[model samples]
Target chain A: MISIRELHKSFGPLQVLTGVSLAIESGKITAILGPNGSGKTTLIKSILGLVKPDRGVIQIGEQVLNGDCRYREDIGYMPQIGHYPENLSLNDVMTMLQDLRGGKHPTDTQLLEKFRLGKEMDKALGTLSGGTRQKVSAVLAMLFNPKILILDEPTSGLDPVASSIFKDALIEERAAGKTIILTSHIMSEVEELADAVVFLLDGKIRFHGSPTEILQNTSESNLERGIARMMQEAVHP
Target chain B: MRTTGKIIKYEIRDIARSKFVLFYFVFFLLLTEGLLRFGGGSTKTLISLSNVVLLVIPLMAIIFGAMYLYHSREFTELLLTQPVNRHQLFRGLYLGLAVPLALSYGAGLGLPFLLHGFNAEGDVALLLVMIGSGIFLTFIFTAIAFWISVTYNERVKGLGFSIVLWLFFAVIYDGLVLLVVAWFADYPLEKAVIGFTILNPLDLARILLLLQMDASALMGYTGAVFQRFFGSFWGISIATVALVGWTAIPFWLGLRRFAQKDF
Candidate 1:
């Protein structure tokens, strides 16, 4: 459902994504795996139109992403940090979103209850803890149930229970045929939730296939070890 | 428009809780009341009130608007990733800031004037220009601040440039003008001076308000040629156009910079 072609981006002199291309199919969870400075986030941000690429095109369905912001209507992005207006209470934040979205989506009570965020809706964003803030970000990302979900470090601050709930939600969304592109360091989570693995390093795709292929190529039983082996192999080969 | 309104709604919520905006409101309210009570006499109080409006409005607008953009950078980025239009996002931000700031100045200076019994037809017309000048300054300077913030990614550097810009207009600019006029005193530099006034938004505001308050105070300095020019409808209209130009130029520059910017 989403396609990226020759995506290249650089911050100053340092190149982030250099001539990278990939396609993310619908009805599946694709985990973008990379080390620090691997340009994984840059690639994701480019697709979300957050980080303007130095060169290339990103096509979602039949339309190319352009200056017209109507394209973003299909996207639900959860940034790594749940940064929000400081003094805005959760209700105000959500209401404002609803108004700006042109009354597109209804209330998202399920995720609110799943994350136990109903009680915290009245608190100002600045007053919330990091994990709680992550929950808020997660809810916002899923609030619209958009065509594609771009989640960066979606479970970093969540507790085990909350993480599991989030994973279950991801599985359920995949079942509903929504495309999800997520980046995370948690290998077990990736192994469980992601159907396809797109391994990136130095701004190029090193591996793109099923999760089982990643393990088979590296001859590693676990997703974590398999990824580590892939990196080591890239360095030597 | 509805999108702009909703964005403005959220921005107002944020600004409503801003410590600087709150402090600004309180400061003006107290300053106006204090000036009216202590300065004494209708004319003196009006002049004093007008002077502070000319000075403080632009200063606070620049400082507060720049700082607000910096502080709300995260929130702005958060909204940018949404389906909201960029133009609406920026227009809302500008209006959201400009509205509260202009209102605070209006209510602060306005209420005192109303209490002081200076609402005659002529006085109201003059009061409007005074208030209009204050609004213009707030709009213009906030636009400049937004421009600086948009151009520079670093907060300290952006704020540094913004403060220096304010200093140039508020402090150094007048010094440079005085030096220019003094050095060229032998020449009838009325045209040059008028051109110079148009260049500086602060000077343009001061000239408009000062002429309305006490034309004679400036008549001696501006002279008969300049006096006739400034005292006429054409002069006021030109100054008004210049104020609106000042408001539009920087705001448009800021919006352009914001449109291409990747958040």
Candidate 2:
């Protein structure tokens, strides 16, 4: 389980996260949905101990995430746009990552081979297409079989088949009792994967509940409409 | 042990292929040869070579090292996501750059020495030229470069700032210091001038070698004071401490900021 409390952050004078708090239960998927500059990314970074919060506590299970903290070992992260050194081959990257993680665990190599990355493992990372890079990123995120997975815009450059396979893997991981936190603009993807949704606007949680419950409470039938309704409610309420 | 070793190896492998590193090595080697030829194989040639090499060496170190830091921004984010600590990562980066730079210096100077075998003076010259200057400049600018990189996000901006500062130290700073001393020449300002010398690494370097060249007569009363203070073991140790502080302080801050930075 991951728990965040009273998280506040700002850059210079422009406050980003403002006393935000949220929680993730074990063996579940929680999707954080918000517009650009709404502090969704900041929230994720704070959880990972990348960004220091002005005020708050973040705990992964029982251990707080801080400087030199090893709580990162439990989380696998896939950034929005993955970038590697231009000269590194895919195999080199994988081996380097495995070395850093300190041991080899079960990676979904069969699926990766199916994606045809096995054949081109020797090719430099800079030469790969965007979709291929996303595939590599997705593969590494799941390679460790981490207790928690944090993916930001994971499906942006993926093909339909690859996206389907990736989603299926998330489902499998969730079934096996790992917590997943993902952020995406794709409503259909969120609707498909999110067991619950946390709606954020202007660094505050507008709403937090099941996707179906959010829609039902807001008198909206679709995720898009539900989000729109919540944003409107946040403005007035 | 295993993880830190892997980080070190990976950093080495990545920087080994950098185009800037290749360019710096070739350019400096050629520059050194050109200066030797221009000086007509005289002792004056060695002095000129030392001055130029020291000036150029630190500049190259800063530019290339800064490039490594900025270019690897996203990759750093990826690294942080792993189970590695910031200190280990920094050690890897520092050693990685230092190894290649040290090798390039050796190769560049060694090639020239092999072409012309070392006499007593030539060996001393080469030791100061290749070994001393190389290590001193590398340590000085590696810290500066890493500081610029971690402090700034934009590549062009950070590098541009470093270039301007390099120009000031290598070319303009001495001239400015001279103007200041000349303006205050009547006030018995030898001690103040000596004090001012501590501010610039270039000046410290010049004082080190010039004293060895036995140029105290040309350097005047201020020279005697400089030689009295800086000529001693304490002076060299002081400069060494300052240079090491240059590395330690900035590296400490950069690592601190980097740990809290949102990649």
Candidate 3:
């Protein structure tokens, strides 16, 4: 479990996150939803320790994040855009990361085989298509079998077939009792995969509950319409 | 420490494969070879080479360092999410960039001389000094460039600051010193001039090499004062310390900023 309290962050007079408190449970999938500039990415980055919050307490399992990076060993991250050294081949990148991570854990190559990335491992990352690179990102994130998986827009560039494969992988991971957090714009994808939804607005958590709870609260038939109604009520009220 | 080494290893490999680094190595190789082949006696060639090294190394190191950091930002963000210490990551990145560039420079300049052979014992010493100075400038300027790159987010602004800094040290600083000397002609400016030279790594390197070449006589009265000062053991020690400080201070500052910076 990852617990955060009173998280605050500002970027040069612009407040991106303000007093965000959340507790992410294990053995479940949580989706963070927000409009652009609503601090969803900032919140995620803060948990990853990529962005240092102005004031907050972030505890992962029993360890509190106080500048120690060892806790990150249990977490896997897939960025929205998988930018890598242009000249490094896919094999080189994978090996380098494995070496850095110390290879202590039993290697997980399920996604690697599923994606059939072995054939393209010799290709330079710069030469790969966007969907292929996204697949590479997905493989690296799952390679360690990390306890927590944070994926940002994991399906954006994927073809329909690859997307399904990715979703299945997520389902398997969740069933294995791993905590999964993801952010996506596609309501249908979130509705399909997310067990709980956390909706952020202007740096604050406006809603946090299961998708059914949001539907019942907003009296909407679908997740998308419920979220839309919530946004409208927040702006108009 | 092991993690840092692993990071450096991959970084070096990535940088080594780039066309720009290859071009850099070749440019220096050809320039050094051309100078030795046609620039008259060994002494004259060495002098010309020192002039080229003083100007070129800093410019190349600064620009390349800034550009490399800016270009690899996304890759850096990717690394940041890993279970790696930020300090180690910064050191790895800094040395990874500095070491390759420094090696390309040293090997490029040294290879031609090794093939040609040194005619005199003094010539050997002078060549070492010249190459040493080039390596020092590379580390110093790369560190400064890193500081600039970390401080500025925009690519154009970071790159522009790098160029302007190179200009100030390589060109404008000398002009300014001359102006200062002329403005205070009667003020017994020898000590002040040495202090000014110490402030600019380029001048310190040039003067250090020139003193070794026995070419200080060509620098007129200021050269005489420099010879009296830098000719001594203490003077060389001080200059070495200054150069080391130049390399360390900026790197420390850059690391501090980088550690706290939000990716």
Q: Which numbered prediction scores highest in TM-score against the true structure?
A: 3
Counting clashing residue pairs in each candidate, in order, gives: 0, 0, 0
Compared to the true structure, candidate 3 yields what TM-score? 0.96
Worst 10 residues of 2 chain A by lDDT: A102-111
> Model 2, A105-169: lDDT tens per residue?
55556557656778668899899988998988888777777899999888889999998988998
Q: For model 1, what TM-score does chain A reach?
A: 0.98
Arranged by DockQ, best first: 3, 1, 2
- lDDT, residue B113, candidate 3: 87
Candidate topping lDDT: 3
Worst 10 residues of 3 chain A by lDDT: A98-107
Off by more than 4 A, model 3: B220-223, B229-231
lDDT of each: 0.84, 0.77, 0.89
User: Candidate 3's residue-wise lDDT over B1-263, tens digit each?
Assistant: 99899889988877877777778888889988898888765677787888789899999999999999998886688788889999999899999999888888888988988898766678888888888988999999999999999999999999999999999998898888899999999798989988887798887777668677786566545456777876746666777788988899999999999999998
Show the colliding residue pairs in model 3. none
> Could you tell which candidate, 1 or 2, scores higher by DockQ?
1
Better of 2 and 3 by DockQ: 3
Model 1 regions more than 4 Å off? B19-23, B119-122, B185-188, B219-231
Query: What tens-digit string does per-residue lDDT give for candidate 1 at A74-97?
Result: 788999887887788888878877
